[model samples]
Target: MSASLTLVVLMAVMYGTGVYVMLERSLTRFLIGFVLVGNATNLLILIMSGPSGTAPLVTGTASDDRMVDPVPQVLMLTAIVINFGVTAFILALIYRTWWLAQLGDEGDTLSDEHADDTEAATEAVFNQVDLDDEAIQRVLDESNEHGDDSHTTRKGAGE
Candidate 1:
């Protein structure tokens, strides 16, 4: 097929793969997906830039149609910088996630039994009380006794 047709198909495949991989729970997969999508975006910007024409800043006389719009090129550069920053931030987050997940031994695997156990553990952790009523009352009472001098203590509206 034609070059443009090939690029369109490639872009579409990139978008599809990016979306599919992003849906995975793995951080590495997500990062790959993000990069794929970003690359696809760059390709889209490049393709939409239209046919190449004479340089806009050429000294010789040139018709308006012959001069390329440099805005898309500028935008593509800006997007590249922005994508770099965003990817860097995401990479940091992925590193942190991987580091945290590495706390367990090397035995951790995505087996069905492990998944069930993980779900149970997650449920147990989530079921824990976020706030203890008695503890909150004690803190409030202490704060009141101290005339709420602590900066971290929160006072009720009526108090």
Candidate 2:
């Protein structure tokens, strides 16, 4: 088999794996998939340039047939850097999501059983309150007695 054919097969497998993992709910799996896809793309770029015959440096005696293309190598280097940045950004997003959810698990935390319980408790509390009733009038009267302004003018020009 040719190098190009092998590279194509490898890239296809990598992309397939990445797509499968991306559908998963785990953040770690998602990151792994992203890395695999990135590496496959980099390898594809290298393979498309054909075999590297010689060094890119000008030795003054090397022939054109012996010289290899340097553009692919340069592009690969840039791609690697960009991939690193993307991975870092993805990790940061996962960390932030974890912090907000107060759990180490990835995906939607609201789908968890504990979140359902919390929602039920909140609903129970809200059900006891009549928002349109005169109970709010007593609360507003107390606030007014404490010198609280229900409608105050702002000093800003936007108001």
Candidate 3:
């Protein structure tokens, strides 16, 4: 097959696959679809760049017609790079979504129980410590020097 025909066929296949993948329910499939479409777009830009020719160097005999169009090449390269970055971002989002899903609904319940246990343990330790007024004032004074606001510290329910 001719080069143009091959490029056209490839682009069509990629585009078709991209559209099909995008219709799936999964985010991972969506990312794949996006990548296929982006690749197709890059191919389209490459096709628009026209046939390869000698370097565009402006010599005494060199004319614009004999020179290759650099604009399309530059545009195609830029588009491919941008598409790559977008694909990476989309992949990251997909990974995050999958990770969160894997955590399951029970994870929240477990985390809540763990938090409760931690709070109870902290309270137990606090009750065992007997800080006199002088010690408390010294801690507050030190906290001020360290740029910490003593008022923002968590207070017990009785306090």
Candidate 4:
């Protein structure tokens, strides 16, 4: 059976709105968008499953065409479980962010401790490697002065 136009339109709207909401910086909005997108995917699967039919296990049913397809239902259930899991994970993240925000003087900003830690980590990585352009150029020049043959020895031309 053909999919209904109304459901298709609704699904499209849901998908569009979900994507739009997901672009926001707020974790809550992202969670809402994720849920909307998940439900829209379920609707899409339903629309594509075709017309409903009798149970596949029903006794005395001789024709396989009349049996309902179970794949779509299974997929929908799987999607639901996955959505729930991701929602929980997002909630946890939101809670963690809120907790961190609370520790700072600003209502929405991270604490100075976190910022200092981040800066320290970044400095540690770059300073340990001496990643500045001048240092890199000096290292390259030193390696050249050492000679390329340091890595490999060439045989005599006649030997």
Candidate No. with top lDDT: 4
TM-score of 3: 0.61
Ranking by TM-score: 4, 3, 1, 2
lDDT by residue for model 4 over 1-159, one digit each (tens)? 889999999999999999999999999999999999999999999999979997767576477668888899999999999999999999999998875664434332355656666556645655767767678899898998766665444434435
Compare the candidates by TM-score and give the number of the best one. 4
Residue 11's lDDT in candidate 2? 89
TM per candidate comes to 0.60, 0.58, 0.61, 0.63
Winner by lDDT between candidate 3 and candidate 2: 2
Q: How would you encode candidate 2's per-residue C-alpha lDDT over 1-159 as one tens digit per residue?
A: 147777788889998998888789999899999999899889888778777687887778847668888999999999999999999999999998775675333322355667666556655555666554567888888888655443442324337
Residue-by-residue lDDT tens digits, candidate 1, 1-159: 123988989999999999999999987898899889999989898888888887767556647658888988898898899889989999999887764563345434345656667756654554554346667888989878777555335454436
Q: Score candidate 1 by lDDT.
A: 0.78
lDDT tens string, model 3, 47-83?
7777788787767673656788788878888988998
Q: Estimate every model's Cα lDDT from 0 to 1.
A: 0.78, 0.78, 0.76, 0.83
Q: Which ten residues in a row have the lowest lDDT in candidate 2?
A: 149-158
